[model samples]
Target: MYLTSMVFLLLGSSTSLLMALFSLYKSVGYFIEWEIISTNSNSVVMTLILDWMSLLFLGFVMLISSMVIYYSGGYMEGDSNMNRFVYLVLMFVVSMVALIISPNLISILLGWDGLGLVSYCLVIYYQNEKSGAAGMLTALSNRVGDVAILLAISLLSVYGGWNFVFYLNSICNDISMGLLSFLVVLAAMTKSAQIPFSAWLPAAMAAPTPVSALVHSSTLVTAGVYLLVRFEPAMHGSKLSQLLLLLGGTTMFMAGLGANFEYDLKKIIALSTLSQLGVMMSVLGFGLADLAFFHLLSHALFKALLFMCAGVIIHSAKDYQDIRMMGGLSKLMPLTTFYMNLANLALCGMPFMAGFYSKDLILEMAFMGSINYISFFMYVFATGLTVCYTARLVYYSITGGFNMGSLHSVNDESSLLTNPMLLLALGAVAAGAMLSWLIVPYPYVICLSGFYKMVGVICMCFSCLGGLCYYLGSFLFILNSLNYYKAVVFSGSMWFLPFLSTQNLMFQFLLNGLYLHKMGDQGWFENKGGHNLHSSLMKSSVLLEKMQDNSIKLYMMTFLFWAVVSIIIM
Candidate 1:
């Protein structure tokens, strides 16, 4: 089953890539038309829906899905339900591909919902209590986002009588469809796990490593960014775009902070995924939609590599996720160490790596945009934080103090795993080198002067230096903990502070995922009006149960009476 699925995925990916390249070269638009008569007028209209953006997205889905299929075959080798896991993975990829090629709102919704369903199944593959709970949480959160999108689509179709192409055309002309744009943007923000909706991604780390890689790198979280880019024309120049920018910026900062404090390897990667998505959102919101797409590609490459490396490490370490328990692993696991470090460098946006070009493009574009100095400072600060946390990840895992009693000794023994890491490492190094040529049309000549290159080199040097200082001072030593120390100082003086407590507050809020659901539940049940409403609902539910029981008996009696009347008539 795995082999067959892998072949099918690879074939689909190759076909999609060929189509994309053909579309690009021939300048022939990719569209599929379906004619439907209006219900009232009976007038036939053809919906022309598809374009380069959709084709590009389809190509991406194909490529990544194929890679994931190959990766999972090896990753799931020892699992008891390996066949079932492979089936679910394939179904998930299929849903994503369907989403990419969907031409109408209904088709897209079906694909989106199917993806969510398959994702939930994959998340709970372990069938553990925690995994099941996490899957339910993910499902609920994703359903909320999906419902918003579905509602927006329904409204557009019902009121505007606009199909996908018609809606795109209208937006291209007006660019002020405020309500529709807001709905879509809201949906996108939630799907991407920005701000208040950000807790689900970390929770979803309860899944297997391959699922985590798929969610973080390509399939699940990228859906939101893909939607934003796909509908850019509809959303440009709207207040929603600004909202997206702010939400993205905030998510980036907060998730990076969370990554710094997290101990679980998968959770750290999950936080980093959120932070990277936030960066991409900011780029897309700022009208650098193309740059966001480029960054998306680079991020997928390196982030998947990182997750795969983490998986191997975790497997060897007997599922120990704490970096404090892992140290000097370079001796036992040279390939894992090398690939992980290389991927981390790319993640940190070190110069000459795959991430450097894309991230620098975003920064340059943001600088040129209308956002003022404060926003630029925020971007720089986020960049610094990214560097710091990523450095900490590398340092603690490979160079920190080693306590053998806390760590298990296991050999790094999988050639199947090492092969994938090698491929990703090569891509990380060489992908950026080809970016300039790959992105350009007609082989146009461009050159950077010696001075410009020097400046770029120096900026990277300073970023690395700052990251090192932060790691040594804040993370490695007690006095270096400026961010944590500042929070302590700020909260220590209030008379209510001791009663509320810093440790309790931190766990109950930040570490407890801000207790958002609790807050919502409090509002729903505890307040005066809410309490009354809950009582009313409980009473109504009892009434509903009684009515349902009575209706079932009534239906049975009616059926019996109808049967006797038929017999008499016969």
Candidate 2:
């Protein structure tokens, strides 16, 4: 029964993907029109006038979704709730499809909200306490972002008074282009988990591996980058664009650092997802919206492959996710190891891999464009950090230790898992080769001076080599002086700066997610008077229940007295 259900689900998703690809092909000359009724008497009409850009994004989304669906079937095999999982997965693709095709803001919001809800459900599908908590956090964070988007939309409607069609027709004229740009940027940062809004993503590793791959790598998070790319014209010359550039650059650097320090394999990948999104965000900031979209396309392919490889390792290791406990498994699991390392190299921006093309384009754009020297240096440094952390992940997973203990005594029974990893591994290698043809009028200008490319290559070499040396030195130092490394570096210091010796203060802050969550929760209950209101509600409810249970005569007399008082007051 489960097998049949899975087959049916795959069929539906594949058919939808094919239809979308066909539509994208036909969209070169096609046009669409629709009507949306408002609460008022007037009707708002719109047209989804397609062009090369929309078709490109549409095709990218479809191709990625098809791969996700195929991998999901293998990942979920033998699970009892296979049917339910497939249903939600398909719904997620449908929502993304609608979002890509929608002409106006309202239609896009409908699809966006649907995807958010389905993602929340998928996060909590395991029904465990940890998964439930993570899902709630994801939903709350997204809801706050949604409220900001709603306010911006309402303000635009009130001030501009332009219907859907007219707004698109005169997008630049109707709105305070500045305000619209700010709102959209905020929405994108929140959705993509940049900086202060980024804690939710690491916690979301509690979900199934397939869910993590689909949401983090391919579909849900990519929506934010897609939005910025789609609405580039409205945001071109605003302060928000500069802010996006700075924030995205900073996020990439910080996230790469965090990924390097993480012990869990899944958390490492989660952090990489954030770092890559930051790079894409920076590309959008540089006005290379087409390049940003193309990077998003390639990232989906390689990152998903990496996650699937990690899943295979975890499954074979008997659910052990800590990279510290894994080593030399390349001998036992040669195929899995090869795929993982291949994907990791691509992720590190090695030449000829999928990531190299997109990342190099962004770096070149940052240097050559109107962005100041400081911003350009920051981006280049972040790219170097990307290489450092990616190398750390690959080394730790395959070489650091042989502490597998007794877990690998038994092996994984499912051949289904290996099949998807093999397919994705091939993608990680070959996807970039197709980029020149896939995108129309390939966006990169390649204006880098010979000196510049040489400097960039040197930086890449240093990052990779430096990271490997650091990892090896740290390991040997730990083996020699175990107490020193643990007491000063691992236990006392922050994740970013591991040499700082302020143990008590750093430990307190780190335990609470750097005090950000504590501050937000305190502000909600204290400044908002939520605690006092809750106490009052509880006391009043208790009194009412007691009065109701005391006596029928007492209740009747109370009601009569209230009725007489009401009439006299009136």
Candidate 3:
């Protein structure tokens, strides 16, 4: 089974890479459409759009998926449902590919729904209570995006077709199409877990590590940013762009702040994914779709490697996900440690690393753009918090005192895990440079001041110092003091987002749904619809039966009444 899976993965990776190269070098694209039906000038069609963007994104997705599956072979070596897990992961890959290549809304929705369903299945693969809850959150959050896409499709029907690409030029000027754009943005926000919709991304860590590596890094969360990128041509200079900028920046700041207070290993990585996602959305908001795509690809390489490395540590630590329970593994598991730190450095946008090429470039361009001071502060602080949390994570998990039990044994597991990490590590290190050259053929002309150029460096330095202070401050005094308790609770709990998205928001919807069922469907329809008609018919039937059962007295009374009326008229 594993061998067959490997063959399939390798074939997919090679094919996508080849197509990406061909599309890039030849500057060619293919858009194929099949008309299924037509009525009143509207057509229902299936479409496949293969261009350099789609091909390149597809290649990265397939490559990461390949590494994840191979890593899972060892990670799930003896699990009884390993075969089922592999199948679900493959289904997820297919769904993402479908989404990447399609230009039509209907076809995109098919892939969109496929990703949501398959992810739900994968999230609940463990078949336990916590997994079940997490799966529900993941499914429901994504369903919002699904419903938005459906609405977009319904709106597109009036345009005579479901293909959005052909309509991008006119959509900005037309008020009707503006709603379509809004729905698309809302869908992307939910899918990408921006702000209020973000609680689910961290909750979804209940799944196994390989799944985490796959879902968080490329396929699921990145789908929204990719959608927005495709829709960006219409969104530029519009109110939607400003709204996206606000929400994206806030989400970036929120996630980075929350990660510092979080201790769960997987959750930290998940929050980082959220932060990076916000960065991509912010760039898209800045009308830099190409840069957003660049970051997306580069981020996938390192983020996936980061998760796999975490998996190795968690597996060896007997599934202890708390960073406080782990420390000083650099000597015991040197290889995993090395790859993890590399990924971390890349995440922190260290000079010349994968993240540096994309993330740093984004900050530079943001400075070049005409953005507000609020946005400027968000970009700077979010960048710093990213480094701060990363440093804290590395210190707590790798370089600190040994905190695990004496009986615990930690070491580099096997070639199955190491080989995949090594492959992704290579990509994590080099993908940024390669993608920059290919995707961004021309260099961005920046005319920033010296202060702006040094902002990123300054942020990293101050953030590093803050991280160091926290690392040593734990012993000196109260790190999380009573004065900061309120702040900690707010940020630590994701600003109470889990409560808001689930208990608060959904609870109202549930009540309304139940009320509709009782009053609208059952009560109102019973009294005013079929039930009312039935009662009126039954009453008329009873009156007729009583009149028909008339006796001699009844006939006499009727005759007397008619005679009296006739006399009065006379």
User: What is each predicted model's overall lDDT from 0 to 1?
Assistant: 0.72, 0.72, 0.91
In terms of lDDT, the best-performing candidate is 3
lDDT string for model 3 (356-436, tens) is 999889999999999999999999999999999999998899996789878887988588989988888888788889888
1-570 per-residue lDDT for model 1 (tens digits): 766776776677667667667776677775766667657756555443455556656665656555666667677788889888877877887677667666566666777888789989988888999899778767866777788878878667644564554576576455445667777777777678787677668878889897887765666788888877777877777677787788788778777766776778888888888889999998877876777877877788788889988988888887888887887777778888888988888888888899897887677667657896666667777777677678778777887656446547555677766765665677677766554344434432334456533444455567667766766775557765565766544322222222233235423654565466566656644664668778889999997887688687878887999999999999
Instruction: Specify the poorest-scoring 10-residue window by lDDT in model 2.
Output: 492-501
Question: What order do you get sorting by TM-score, best first?
Answer: 3, 1, 2
As for candidate 3, its clashing pairs are: none
Query: Model 1 — TM-score against the truth?
Result: 0.78
State the lDDT of candidate 2 residue by residue for 1-570, as single tens digits.
334544554455456445545654665434577666665777776656455555555555555555555666676776889888878877887788677766567667777888789999998999999899788777766775687677667766754553233453355554555666677678777788875567677777888888887777877888888888877766666566788888888777777767766788998898889888888888777777878887887888888888888887887787889988777777677777787888888887788888777777677767778888777777777677778877777787777556777646523445666665665677678877676455533455567788777666788899989999988898667666555656434322124232221234334645776466667767665655788788888999998888869788888888999999999999
- Candidate 1 Cα misplacement greater than 4 A, ranges: 34-51, 158-162, 172-176, 400-409, 433-460, 473-570
Which pairs clash in the backbone of model 2? none
Q: Which one wins on TM-score? A: 3
Candidate 1 Cα lDDT to native: 0.72
Residue pairs clashing in model 1 are 473-480, 474-480
